[model samples]
Target: EPEVTQTPSHQVTQMGQEVILRCVPISNHLYFYWYRQILGQKVEFLVSFYNNEISEKSEIFDDQFSVERPDGSNFTLKIRSTKLEDSAMYFCASSEALETQYFGPGTRLLVL
Candidate 1:
């Protein structure tokens, strides 16, 4: 399957600001997910969406974060308020089922 892809490979923002990360998951995949890896920490799952609704999400995905499928091919992750800790590499992924996922190159966000 073709891998997922994210736009604006890098982003720089100020604390308390908002950022919307865009993604295009594999066309045929039914499940899409967002994850982030801090500079030195393990990759952490943020949220997963299917059939236009969120199927699951981690605690880290609080009110500050949201996911949406605005169209047939575009999926988006919006961070309502940025924080220094929000700096990380955000990855978009897609899977045929709940199994193996194909990850994108990632968008590196730097909150200053």
Candidate 2:
């Protein structure tokens, strides 16, 4: 069975610092996405990447954020500058199609 994996399960950084979170999805999957949940808040979509290009992005994915697929197996999310409000649990997900998405455990980010 294939599953998504994330690194640095928890991170703490000062405001204004840059952060890069890493994820590796199931090998045969075609679609990738990033989502975030602010503690008690609901999950919100950040961006979706497919075929080496961004297929869709939300307003939350502003200039401050970026996504990349460094190699055939790894995907990354970079936050150029972190803000206190950016503290949240970030999730990486993948799916063969838009109907079902398999999510990673998540990386908890805390900005102080």
Top of the candidates by lDDT: 2
Model 2, runs deviating above 4 Å = none
What does candidate 1's lDDT look like per residue over 10-103, in tens digits?
9999999999999999999999999999998999999999999999999999999999999999999999999999999999999989999999
RMSD of 1: 0.8
RMSD for each of the candidates: 0.8, 0.6
* True lDDT of residue 53, candidate 2: 93
TM-scores of the candidates are 0.97, 0.98
| Native-to-model Cα distance after best TM-score fit, residue 97 in candidate 1, in Å | 1.2
lDDT of 2 by residue, 1-112 (tens): 7899998899999999999999999899999999999999999999999999999999999999999999999999999999999999999999998779999999999999
Candidate 2's TM-score: 0.98
